[model samples]
Target: MTPRTPDAVTVFGPDFPFAYDDWLTAPEGVGSIPPEHHGAEVAIVGGGLSGLVAAHELLRLGLKPVVYEGARLGGRLRSEHFGGPDGPVAEMGGMRFPISSSTFFHYVRTLGLATAPFPNPLTPASRSTVVDLEGETFYATSLDDLPDLFREVADAWDGALDRILHLGGLQAAIRRRDTGALKAIWDALVPLWDDRSFYDFVATSEEFQALSFRHREVFGQVGFGTGGWDSDFANSMLEILRVVVTNCDSDQHLIRGGADQVPRGLWSRRVDDAAHWPEGTSVESLNGGSPRGSVTGIHRVRDSAGTATDRIAVTDESGETREYPAVLATCQSWLLTTQIACDEELFSQKMWMALDRTRYMQSSKTFVMVDRPFWNDVDPATGRHVMSMTLTDRLTRGTYLFEEGPEDPAVICLTYSWMSDALKMLPHPAERRMELALEALSHIYPGLDIRSHIVGDPITVSWEDDVHFLGAFKGALPGHYRYNHRMYSHFVQQAMPPEERGLFIAGDDVSFTPAWAEGAVQTSLNSVWGIMAHFGGSSPATNPGPGDLFDELGPIRLPD
Candidate 1:
């Protein structure tokens, strides 16, 4: 069948709309610093994808980046190998990435990582899908095989989106990089949706209202693109709109081996085009092959005259202090108040309110490695594969199967759930979680013995339980547009006071599209621009950065 849209959709901001992919791939490169500041040190507090991206780019711009990671290098891009380093991995976080994430794919291409289509429900990659809602099980190779109710729900959603939100027009604007048209559509949506929940949008829309309440329930369980968005029903409708219009959930892919390789590759990859650094220089070699300890405090330094300066002091967990001319904090937003002792004067009260008000949604995943891809075996009675990518309203919610090869051990993500579902598994151990997932799946695939094919230990993760990362990722609540605007626009510091100038932030939490790696990459580029301008550097006129066009193309501001 032919695709709906011929042009590929990109995350070209319904918010900032800056073309980061173009800036990174420009002939002149991002920007350059003065020779005097070639070797100036910049502190990056977090070794996640965002921090690593900033560090990698900063090195190319002829600056030294000192990265401090409390736990591991790849924060949420964690991949847990089952048997050994070369064995199959269970991607605990960020398993699937959409094709619209151009900025992120830039790094993936540069790093030479191989990728394949992820097995989302109803996708060709999964081959077949089994959707078991309430107690009924249906097997299908595509959406056509599903019942009329499923199609009705899908059609209702599309109708509601196009009618209420102008989905197609906004997406066309994003695809063509028409900033004015995109903003005209999205800016109007900011106030309209910022104060409303996603559930409210669906419940109140004329399309779903025409159908029975059961349609809404089915819509939540078997959502569009990915499975079951009921977990995000409480999120702002603007957030949901951004995901839909930008195609953040469609045409997704997974990095072969593991997603963590992206960040780790950036850390160790040599920068051939780096300015002042030598041929073999990398973020790893710059920091002596490893990141520093956790940061405990951050303060703006005062000179002999007792006046605040651009120099910022960073204190590690060992109580060792180092001063830098600029500091880019890419950690979770709550860390500033909870984990780190940041000075009150570093951020304005309004900025502080934005940071403090940021809400994070919980997420949990349980994975088990099996001896082989037994699920591919045929069931003569049912004339279907023993198992298919399963989506159910049961406790498991969504179960994904990953097959490396027929002979190789296969990895099964038993349960990938969020919000209330994730919270339910938080208190349970990995063994108990696996047991609960297997029991739930048994209801869908009765008479199938899943435990017999187990190869090794099961892997489980509750992101909120981790101290270093307070929560999985930010979920913008109702009336959060103002807060999101504050954080997203914080990169442009020319108008800010000197004391709050050098301390910048970058991460998915600080971006409009949180919980996506594209957001992390884009925000990191923004901070790179902010840090560049901090040291008297500028992007080439041909390839002006986000900050250069902030006055005209930045996110629209709402009244106080």
Candidate 2:
């Protein structure tokens, strides 16, 4: 049997701001009714940011849409904490909010949440050290120094950075769907294809290769070879450039309280109301058919009990089956493919064969709560005193420590990038990730009396082992564009008119974001707009594809 409780998603509630109203709730006064959702104006599945945002917009339009979330409402945006008074808060997932978030800013402002730019504490005096398995080291005076040295070395090398710039310009043109510009970028970057994998590009690229020699073990932590310190490496450059041009505004911030403060509140509304939904009942199946389930609701489905059910058929977690007209699947493509068996071969072909090509990236989140901010003056990890530093070390490419509380400071999380690494490190496939963090810290701070100041044990999670999510976040890895384009394309049958069909799927994974809160919200906006338009209602949606989403949130080029 699969474990019912997930690691981070298990903890979600009023503490966060998720605009969704829960369904599995049994709080005070909220009466229960048998499961019966035969006919509703509209039913949205998956109560993450997308589902909630769409429901909110629908409500505003005077349309009462019923949302059916099988799992925790906030989905991945939920929170998990342990210990007690005087103990540390360990975040099982998610990270700090960057002020440059455009879509995030729109909703945050709606909830009256203030914003601050992401701070850079790595200073000249910071302890920015790059250590290797063999014990060689290079120290930087400040965080800026790392990038500067990288820039100098990179400049002395080949013209890869220049090629990347040209590619960025080309991408800008492509976003406009301008054939001319797209061709230009393609032409400029396509030539470098001779270098084989992005790993090869970095290996041959200048000082980039020196990192492996200098900090072999620490290198993997921050990402080395193709995924490491060489931000200018072909694939890595593409990844960074995409975010740069998109959120070019530059404001990075954290919520006033913590990360979950936003997504959780949104999920609470419905759960608190409880009066609107039936008790102990959830959406069994929705198939598109007539005026009701006409949008192919619940194509081919399975009960919570793991029995393979039909889409046009419905079955409870127990043993029950009913037919419907349409089905809206908000799960990931993999889940949708594995669970919902569709009659239409086209949707199946695009989803199973097309979207499944690319691999999911592995990731780990680590949070350390120290007795005091010993590293605040000079970050022992980065050699520089920057508030945060991206360790080019192979061990963990990303690292950030914060002294939020002066008395007993609780350093926030520093998540490192991974590629299918979570599976090798996690508990099990489809299992909740409670990562093996001791390995990384032991390698870096092997002898530091961590037991002395360490308030409680650190919390870590690896997403690679998660079968449901496959991996934590999906990235446009080497040759990803070719694979990515298919994911957001054909799987969704846009051919069906929204009102008559009533069959659609929406989630963070539907679009290029494949992950991230921004992708989640935009998916809601996009799907809802299409659905509304199909139903003769119109809604304006602002989604920043490749152009630059942060523009909507305002310029982030300032320091908070």
Candidate 3:
């Protein structure tokens, strides 16, 4: 049985400018567009979550949005099927999503998608968990079930939060939306923590320093929230603090059916009749069921006489060109440099530097389907299930189990590794990866014949090897705070020159929280507002937009 929490934990609210949940519930559409401009088309590049969100919202405001996706709809939210469309799925990209992702959840709930609590490490959803390290094995059902030493390490982590970061206090300020209080606390710490690495913060903490190196090693191996964070030790402490303080790593859930449904649903969903479109208009119908051809180049549009106008022109791979008054690029920022041919003057040199300097982490996952939820079988001798959600210092850093029903085919993420660990499997075939994972699992499960229940083919992914996606997600390293600041602020194109005014950027990487889907949602909304305002439209007076409140609630800027 899962052990109960020894104490109550604080539930923090989202730490961002936008309150998307509220907007979704009572959406006073953005300022109305003049009748003449109601049918104006807006180019939405990248049909991922951000781009879809932008397009969906834009369509509601009586505008026509044409989405240009280079590949599939869901960018990093890929959920691949195994045997057939009805077969068990392997979540190749994002799987677990935090409940605090209220904005992203708004759409999930709106679409009527079912969700189950993600079995994160020793959480209650997990029947059992085994932590293996250096040939030592420990079984636990909750934090209370771990050894007392583990408890001491956990307490030290909390103490570090209270003393150095004032996590609870900051969370309170964010919940209250006390801009002054939040800014005062966060701005002061931005400089203090931005330049420091997460490892440096942990090493210098009095609580951690009092503990032995073994304790630190254990904490790094099986950290709370999102499994082992050792891969992120070299990243900026501010990034780690932001994740923890905002509650981005806890109370997570996975979308039932698949995460891809969110974007696809938006694509085929028809909204009420608006400006140029009839009552049944949808993104699918707008582009005739698929995205426009892959975009090859982007520059300003010219008139019949060849004089460039304020409109932006996008050229597809087949040499078809379309011009729009404004464009939102929601693809990975790295694509601007590697895949697409974008004019250098479209972005300032500093902005270009930030885009190019953006860092992405490597991530790998290998999954397989079983005949049944075999892990649920009881071992009479040990009085434990045959298998449990496993975390190990071995080659397989994390293993997750998912069951649809008692007899239904279950899924197992044999291995989920990051950074150097992920790179180790980059060259291996799926079968070889399964072999390596099974070998590593043997160390934890002992003599168990775990392979007997296997049903169909295995699936594997090494994000770094994918040409379209050079890496998994941004893992901001020290000194990257400035770069993030630059990227996040690019939506404010009103301050730019006329030539650079038509392009708006939105994506998870452009958000303060680089890896979370909420970031993508919020940043996309920012672009939505920017695009509306650009077209001489305004959000209802009752609901001022992000741009309207930028002076009061914008992200905290740090000193150079």
Give the number of the best model, judged by TM-score: 1
Give the better candidate number (1 or 3) by lDDT. Answer: 1
lDDT (Cα, tens digit) per residue for candidate 3, span 34-66: 667777889988988999999988887778889
Ordering by TM-score: 1, 3, 2
**Estimated TM-score for each candidate:** 0.98, 0.64, 0.95
lDDT of 2 by residue, 210-304 (tens): 54443322322333212243332334334444343333213345554445655554433332133344332222211111112212224444479
Model 1: runs farther than 4 Å from truth?
A: 1-6
Candidate 1 TM-score, C-alpha based = 0.98
- Residue-level lDDT tens digits of model 1 in 209-257: 9999999999999999989999899999999999988889899999998
Best by lDDT: 1
Lowest summed-lDDT stretch of 10 residues in model 3? 1-10
Task: State in Å the error of residue 19, model 3.
Answer: 1.8
Among all windows of ten consecutive residues in candidate 2, which has the lowest summed lDDT?
8-17
Query: What is the Cα root-mean-square deviation between model 3 and the actual structure?
Result: 3.2
Candidate with better TM-score, 2 vs 3: 3
Candidate 3: count of backbone clashes, pairs at least 3 residues apart or interchain: 3
